[model samples]
Target: MKTSPLEQTRFWQAQALGDIEMLHARYVQQRFAPHVHEGYVITIIESGAQRFWHRGSEHLAPVGSMVLINPDELHTGAKAHEQGWRYRGYYPDTERITGVLDELELKRCGLPIFDASVIQDPQLARAFSGLHCSAEHDASALEQQTAWREAVLMLVQRHARVRGTPLPGHEPGAVARAKELLDSLLACPPSLEQLAAEVGLSPFHFARVFRQATGLPPHAWLKQRRLGRAREMLRQDCPPLTVAFALGFSDQSHLNRQFKQAYGVTPGEYRRACSGH
Candidate 1:
């Protein structure tokens, strides 16, 4: 019932992206006031500990743990330890993630759940941090908007599974995991060699099934995703350099060549024309 200064100040703030926010909170503060947001909540505790009230009980959020809160669910963040807590969160619009699930033909999971402990997943974290930074402020002189979208997509493709569950006639198995993995990592990407290792399939076999399921070659899928994300970033006021690097291109020149080839416009020229120079 009672809240502290950190609690009130630590609440969610609107973001540039329709469905993202960076929540700064302290440990052992007041309850989240039984509120609901229009999007999903993906939070990573930076330090200290947190106790979130939801589902009729308190959930302990230790540093390193990933918290996935379902959209429109009632929840709150407070301290669980003496030191306090800091978190990087992405409150993505339900439709954004759901659209991807629909595109992937995935069924929706009723509610989101938390992993028992924090995962050793730098990729997910990278995607999350990028989302918050971009959403917090519009691109200034030149920041990377493209990179931000890339991260958000990566987070969605990789971490959105549990949230969306599976679509009808979906087969749950290792092959499923492989598909999910590919969706998450679309840049700098991975070779069949390493990818095969992840799913315990021969590269050749994996390729076959991947094509069958997604109707696209592995490498091609990665490129399409990266380019698609890049295009979204170009719509924002972010710097070209950041976009190029974030999309896994060598640099602006590299991005220029590929981008023009793909979409018929250089990143800078496109942003200037679209978002305003």
Candidate 2:
């Protein structure tokens, strides 16, 4: 006798993405009643297929397809294939979408809407899928935040009819100041909004300007700075654990992974080499 595969669901908030809700689910016999979400529903079907009803129409979302539902829309969901479906979903409120558009100062009369329930853009699917994986795997806040904005911008521009606005102008002084702040607070960096406020720029605009000036987003820059500082301390024979804690890494392993990725050697090995141990 064989047992049925158990359904799995993991729901969590992406604190880095403004605490937006996310879902990763695999369903075999699960069924969603006709219901509505207070936020927009964006999902990428990873395997199998899902059948759902929305706006008096039935739709099928198979592998490599995306299901998009605007806010407050009633929809129902169940397996479209025998094996069920696995998907990663993003639930962001109207403000979250609008905020991204607002950052670029796009001239829009109202909220952007998705005219279709399902789409098959491979590039978009890859972007959003990669984003979901990054958030799930605890990617750095800077990376997550940057990816979120880019992916959302792409989604709206490609499908929702949102037009592009001019790129943000440069602000060298503000960029330098923001970097100083980030460097001073490596163990507990400020959020994007807070960092922007410190420099008199909006969060997204600051991020764009920082990227333009430094060739990296604030978070990525912070990451590099942290790794650099770790190297300095390791050269002084500091332990990996101490380096991790001092630089705001999650743990020694976290430092190990990033340090190796950057310099091709673990902190311990680097420390040994520098000290001639």
Candidate 3:
């Protein structure tokens, strides 16, 4: 007798990406009944293979391929490989897809659709996989937001046949004002939407503009500023916990991770060196 691999499933909302739902799952014995999703389903097969039923036919999705289902489509899923399949999936409503297109002012005859149920574009697969990992790990809002737009644009252009138009030109004044706002609200920074609204631009457009001008999206830029402030506080003998809370890190561990990544030293070590301890 042979043992089957254990099953695992995680479903969560990515608040950084406007609360879009995501899933990372591996299954050996599970079978999905015929169902319809009100939103679009985009999934990448990471290992093994998946056999699914859609549009009156059975389909196989091997590893490194992406399965795309448009909104309100019926589908069924099960394992096609002996060991089962592990996949990362994104469920985005019509607004999530259209919103990115609208920001670019792309001409659209109707909502974008994916005629193919599965695709073998390695670039797109890698882009979406990385985006899923970033969201799963709670990356900064700016990085996640910017990545989501770029990935969706690539998907729509390559697979969904969405044509592109030139993006809006830069607005230096708006970028400056947005930066000031972010600087002032470091402890409780505004969301992408809020920052955009304050600067009189759409959220995605504002993110683009900020990235173009600053070489970093709003949240990433804010992170650098926070780290700088953390260093200042540490030099003044502030405790690590106090610095973490004051700089809006989720916890001391969060601060430690970011600090080490940026400065190559833990917060405690930095503090000790500064205090001559």
Candidate 4:
């Protein structure tokens, strides 16, 4: 893709907790070469239109429609309108998605698959759009988490093709040990590999089982734990910067960003509110 001074592609790991990445881009002249992502792609078009080659066919996803690209599917993207296409997208791994599905009592027959590449559902569109905004703007953790689950549930229930079965059993003892280690070292948690080793499992296996037990991956669980601790300390009137250091955050802004994401208010504002301001 040739870089145009006016073209914009803003990509970031989604600010919310989960195994998700985000892209909010406006592309005019850029054409994406054939590519594949290791995770499922869910996107809602904001304006203009997109022409994409998917599943051996070319398709159009215009404004107000959602695009579903299954994992490892080869696809290409290019503008379909003069104004180009503006969209917000989320790429979530299979494990994270399955975790969400399990919450809804939906079974992953093999892997949840989508037959339609382009879908026009106002409800799903609104749900995904809201999730994208909440994640981008650091909405409350509860809000972001709720939006994510709701959107995924809606999508899977309505669009996915999967057989009905119960989620797998969890290793409660192993998961508990892992949680203990995490809580014991809140300031400097171990790497995923290291944690998995300590818990006597491979990293990938640990991740899958951990999500089964806790409804979150290790990294996201640790983040939420830290943020939760930050909230307790903040309520006690601890200095935000000091709390940041104690919680092993990069800085107060790091703590602030997370705090806002969990509480829908910045640390300072939260402090003032707690002080009866």
List ranges where model 4 is wrong by over 4 Å: 163-277
Worst 10 residues of 3 by lDDT: 162-171
Which parts of model 2 have CA positions greater than 4 angstroms off?
1-5, 162-277
Model 1, CA-based lDDT: 0.59
lDDT of 3 by residue, 43-74 (tens): 99999999999988999999999999986566
Full-model lDDT, candidate 3: 0.82
Candidate 3 local Cα displacement, residue 88, angstroms: 0.2
TM-score of each: 0.44, 0.57, 0.57, 0.58
Alpha carbon lDDT of each predicted model: 0.59, 0.82, 0.82, 0.78
Error of 3 at 58 (Å): 0.7
Q: What is candidate 4's lDDT per residue for 1-277, written digit by digit as tens?
A: 1346656655555546563667677778777655556578899999999999887799999999999988756677888999888899887778778988777776456678899999999999999998888887878889988888888888988999963443544446678899989988999999999988998999999999888876568877787778767766866788788899998999988887666433334677655534434
What's the CA RMSD of model 2 in angstroms?
A: 16.2
C-alpha RMSD for every candidate: 18.9, 16.2, 16.2, 11.2
Leading candidate by TM-score: 4
Q: What is the lDDT of residue 144 in candidate 1?
A: 39
